[model samples]
Target: MQRRANVELRTAYNAFIESKRMSDPASGLTEIPALNQTLKPHQHDIVTWALRRGRAAVFAGTGLGKSFMQLEWARCVAEATDMPVLILAPLAVAAQTKREGEKFGIEVKHCREQSEVGDASIVVTNYDRLQKFDLEHFAGVVLDESSILKASDGKTRTAIIEAFKDYRFRLACTATPAPNDYMELGNHAEFLGVMTQEEMLAMFFIHDGGETQKWRLKGHAESEFWKWMCSWAVMLRKPSDLGYPNDGYDLPPLAIEQITVGVDHDRAQDTLFVMQAATLQDRIKERRETVEERCRAAVEIIARKPDTPWLVWCNLNSEAELMTKLIADAVEVRGSDKVEDKERKLLGFTDGQIRVMTTKPSVAGFGMNWQHCADMVFVGLNDSYEQLFQAIRRCWRFGQTKPVNVYLVAAETEGAVVANLHRKEADAERMAEQMVAHMQDITVATIRGTSRTKTEYNPSVEMTIPQFLEAA
Candidate 1:
C-alpha cells in the first residue's frame, strides 16, 4: 500500500510540473522582425529575445548600449502592436535617451506631463511623474534603471506595479542587480507579474540568521530558482556572454587608493581601547567627529590635480560645502537645489564646464554617464555597498580612456566601515560569478533560439480503479 501511495504522489507532482510549464503564454507572444543594420549582433539578439518573451528584464552592465536596445525594442513593439510605448527614465537621462533615439532615426518625444505627450510612438518621462500619465494610452512600458523600485520607501514601487498590472509588454533594463540584495529582483518579479515578493521568498528562499536577517536561496532550490528566473528575464554583463564578439565592451582598469587621516577620538569614553566599530551608533559617532579631518584629506588630494576633471562624493552637507570652498572652481549640488539647477550642474560637469562637482551618491549615482572623468574621491564611506559600487562605476564604466582612480578618504577610526566595504565587494564579486554561471546556459539557449518547450506527456501504464469506490 505504501509503495502504491508513493507512486501516485510522484505521478501527481510530475503532472503539476508539466502543466505549469505549458501555461506560460510568453512562448506564444508575437515575434517581431529582425533589428536594423545599425544594431550590433549582440544587440540584435537581445532585442529579438525580449520581443519573443514580451515581458522581460535585461541586466546589461553600464556602457553596453542598453539605451539602444531599449529604444529598438520600443520601436518594434510600437510597430507591431500599433500602440505607443512609454519609457520611464531618471532625471536628465530622459534628454540623453531622446538624443540617442534621434541618432538611430527613431522619433522619441520627451514630455513633462501627459498633455505634452504627442503623436510620437515613443514617449520618455522621468519616473517621479509616472502618476501623471494615463495608462490606457500605451501598449508597453520600459523602465530604465529599474532598481530604483527597491528603495526604502515602497510607495513608488507599489505604484508602478499596480499601475501597469494589465500592460501586455514590459521591459526592465538596468546594470547588474546586486546579488546580496534579493529585494531588488523581487521588485522586478512583482512588476513583471511573474510573482509577488512574498511568493518568491516563500518559493525559493530561507531566512538567514545573520545580523542582516536577509533572505537567501535554499541550497536545494538555487538551481531551480535561477532556471525559473531565466524563463522571464535575461542577465548579461557583456556581449560575449551571449556568444558575440566583446570588442569595445571591455572596461578600463580601476585603481583604488585609501587615504587615512588622523582624528582625536577619546577611546576611553566610547570603549576600553581603540577597536573596530560593531554598531550603527559607533559608526555614526566616528563619522561625525572626524568630518573635518576627512574633508581636509579629500581637499588636499583634489588640490594636487586642479586642472583635471574631478567628481567628489560626500555624505554630509558640511563636506560638500568644505570641498567647494577648498577646491578651486568646484561646484556643489545639494538636495534642496531646484530641479533645473541640479540638472544644469550635472550636465555641466559631464560636458567639461564644471571642473569639479560635489554631491552625494544617493543624489546622482544611478543613471548618469560620466565616463569622461577618471578621478573621484569619497570623503565619507557608508555601509551601503550598492551606493558605493554605483558611485565608482559612474566613471569606471566603458568608453573611459584613462585608468580610473578612486580615493577612499576616511578617518583612522572609520577603518571598520572601510573594511566592511571591502568584504562586501569581495562577496558581491563572487555572487555575480555564481549568478552569471547559472544564467549563462539559459541566456545562450534563449538568444540562439534553441530553448525547448514543454510537450504533452502520456503515461504508458494502464491503471484500474480501486475497489473501495466502484461506480454507483
Candidate 2:
C-alpha cells in the first residue's frame, strides 16, 4: 500500500512540474500557406516561422533581405486575416520599402495620414506619422526598424508598445536589439507581449547592488532566459547562424582608417601640455574647435577617390555646413530640414544622383541601404557606438562588391572618445556572440519547425516512500 501511495505521489508531482513548464502559446496560424516565390530560402523560412509564431521579432542583420521577409510576412498576414496590415518604418525607409514592394509585386501604399489608407491591403508609413492612423483598422502591424522602441524618447516608445499590445499579428525587424544592454531586451519582449519588462527582470535577472537601474541576468537563470527568448524571437547575424547557406550573404572586407588631425598645444588654456578630452562637454568643445582641420582631412580622403560615392556623417550643424561647403557637389541633410527634403536628398544618394552625401547618423543611420557607395567618412566621433555601427553598416553591408572603406576623422585630443568607442564595439561584439550562441540552436530548430520548449521530466533516481508514510 505504501509503494502504491508513493507511485501516486510521484505521478502528481510530475504533473505539477509539467504544468509549470515555460511555453509560448502559438497565437499564430497553424498552417502557413504558400509564401512568395521570389523569397530566398532563408528568407522564406524566416517568414514562415514568423507567421507560425503570430507575433515575433526577427533580429536579422542588415542587408540579409529583412525588407523582403517583412514584405512577404505582411502580405501573407493580410491575405490570411483578410484585413489590411500596417508597416511602420523610419522616415525615408518607408519610401524605400514602397519601392522594394513594387519590385516584389506587392503593392505597398505609402500614406501620410489615416484618410489616405483607405482599402489598401498593405500600407506603409513612417513612425512619425503613426499618430495619424488608427490601430483598430489593421489586423497586423510590422515595425521595420523596431529598435526604435528602445532608441526613441520614452514617450514615443511607450506609445508604440501601448498601441500594439493587443494586435493579432506583429513583427519587428532590426539588426541591433540591445546588443550590449540586456535590459533593452525588455523593450522588445514587452512590445511583443511575450512578457512585461518587469516580469522578465523578476524572473531571470538580479540587481547588481543598490543601483536600481542596472540589472544583470541571474547566473542560474541564464539558460532559461534564453529558452524563453527563443520561444518568441529569432536572432541571426547571418544565414549560416541558422544552418542556411551564406552564398550571397557574405560581407566584403571592411577597412577602417582612423585619421587624427593635429591640435595646437600652444592654444591650451589651462595647461601647457595637451590632455585627452575626458568629459562630454570637453569632447564637444574639442570637436567644435577642430572642425575645420577634421573636415579638411575628410576632404583630402574624398579627393583620393574623386569620382567615388562617399557617405559622410557629421554630428553638428556646423560640421555639416563646413563639410558640404568644402566638398563641392556634396549634398547635406540636416535635422532642421523638412521631412520631404530629407527623404528627397537621401533617395537621391541611394539612386546615385548625389555622389557625396553629408548627414548625421541620427538622421540617416537607421534603415538606409547604401551598398552602392563603398566609401564612407565620419567627420568626427560621437560616443554612441550603435549610431557609429549603423552608420558604417549603411555602406558596408552585403551586396557591395568593393571593399568598404571607413575613415574616422577625429581631433588629436579626442583619443578618449576613440578608445571608448573601441571598447564599446568590443563589448557589443562579445555580447552579440553570446546572444547568438544562446539562441542559435533553438532558433535553427524553430525555423525547421521542430523546436520544443517543455522541460523534459526524467526521474533518474527511484522514488522511495517517505519514512513517515511508511511508518503510517
Candidate 3:
C-alpha cells in the first residue's frame, strides 16, 4: 500500500509540472510585435508561470527587472484572459510601472479615470489606492514589491488579499519575500490558494504554543521549503545565474574604507542617550532627524570638492528638504512622486545636470541605471539587504570609470550596526544565505504576530561642530 501511495504522489507531482509549462490559449490572445525585443530570460520564466499556474510568485532580485517582469506578465495574461491587469506597488514605484511598459512598447490604460475598464489591457495603482478601485473587475492581479503587504492585518494588505481573491490569475513579486524567516511565505501562499498559515503549519511546519502559533523549524525544512516553492515561486540572483549585458565594459575598481569620525563628549553623550536610552523614558523625547549642521557639512563636502557628482541617501522629508542649501537644484524621488518625475530625475542625473538626488533605497533602487556618479552616501539604513545593494550598485555598475566610493553615515554606535550590514551583504554572494539577521525580528513578528513596539531614536553618541569639522 505504501509503494502504491508513493507511485500516486509522484504521478500527481508530474501532472502539476506538466500543466504548469503550457501557455494559456484563449480567444483574447494578442501579441505585441515588440515583446521579444524587451523581455529577458528570467522574465520569460515569470511570464510562462503566470499564463500556466493559477497563481505564483516571481521573487527575482532587485536590479534584475521585476517591474518589467510584472508588466510583461500582466500584458501576457491580459491577451489570454481578456481582462485588464491590476498592479499594486509602493507609491514611488507604482508611478514608474506604467512607463516601464512603454519602454517595451506596451502601454498601460488608466482604469481609475474610466467608468469601466475596456479593451485596455493593463492598469497600475499604489497599494494605498487599491481600495478605491474595484479589484474584482480585472481578470488577474499582480502585486509589486509584495513584501510591503507582509503584515497580514494592515488595512492595505487585507484589502489587497480580499480584492484579488477571485482572480483566475494572481502573482506577487519581490526580491526577498522572507528576508527574515519562513512564515513571511504564508501570505503569498494563501493569496495563491496554495495553502493558508494554518494549513501550512499543519502540513509542513512545526508550530509553537496553542494560542499565538509561532514557528520552529520542521526537520528537513529548508529542502522541503525549496521543493514546495518550485510550484509557486522562482528566485534568481544577478551576475551569477544571469550574466551582465555590459560585461565587456570596464568597471571602476571599488575601494571601500572606513573612517571613524570623532565627536565632542557632551554632544556624544546627548546623541548616545537619544539613540539608546532616551527613547525608554517619557519626558525625554529623542529624535534622529537631522539638524541644519549635518546639511551644512554635506554641502561643504560638495562645495569644497569640484565637479564630483554626489548621491546622498536620506530618510524623512525634512532631511532631504535641507539639501537645497548645498545643491541649488537638489531633487528627491519619494514613493509619492508621479512616474514622469522619476524618469526626468534619472535623465538629469545621467546628464550630470542634477548634482544631488536624495532618495529612499527601495523605491529608487531598481528601475533606474545610474552609472554617472561613482560616489554614494547612505544617510539612513533600511532593514532589507536587497534595497541597500540596489541603491549602491547604481554607481558600482559595469560602465563606471573611477573607483566607486560608498560612505555610510550614522551615529557612532549605529556605525557598528551599519558595518555589520555590509559584511553580511558580502557573504550573501557566496552561500546564498537568504536570511538577514536583524530583519528576522520583523519576519518573526509577522509569523507569530504581536503588537508592534513604538520606536524613537536617542542618539547614544554626539559630536561638537569644531571636532566633527576637523575629522572631516
Whole-model lDDT values for every prediction: 0.81, 0.86, 0.59
Backbone clash tally (model 1): 0
Tens digit of lDDT per residue, candidate 3, span 1-472? 6556556666776676556442322211223322445566545544654455547777665556777777887877777776788887654455457666778777876444435456678987756566567666788888887776664356766667777776777888876565334566777876766666566666567767785646765777654554454445556545334222433344568755433333334654545443332222321112143334445555655665457787877654565667654577678766677756765776677678888788777566654556668877665554567667667776786546678887655444334545667677666553344422112222212212222111112335532234443444
**TM-score of candidate 1 against the unseen true structure:** 0.89
TM-score of 3: 0.68
Positional deviation of residue 308's Cα in model 3 after best superposition, in angstroms: 5.4
Please identify which of the two predictions, 1 or 3, would achieve the higher lDDT against the true structure. Answer: 1
The candidate scoring highest on lDDT is: 2
Off by over 4 Å in 3: 1-38, 110-118, 151-153, 206-216, 239-259, 267-297, 300-309, 316-318, 332-353, 361-374, 382-390, 393-404, 426-472
Poorly placed runs, candidate 1 (over 4 Å): 1-23, 27-29, 208-213, 265-273, 416-418, 443-445, 448-472
TM-scores of the models, in the given order?
A: 0.89, 0.90, 0.68
Candidate 2 — which residues are off by over 4 angstroms? 1-24, 210-212, 416-419, 443-445, 448-472
Error (Å) of candidate 2 at residue 88 is 0.3
Per-residue lDDT over 164-279 for candidate 1, one digit per residue giving the tens place of the 0 to 100 score: 98888899998868877888888888888777789788878998678654788999988777777766777777877666789988788898888988766575476676665567
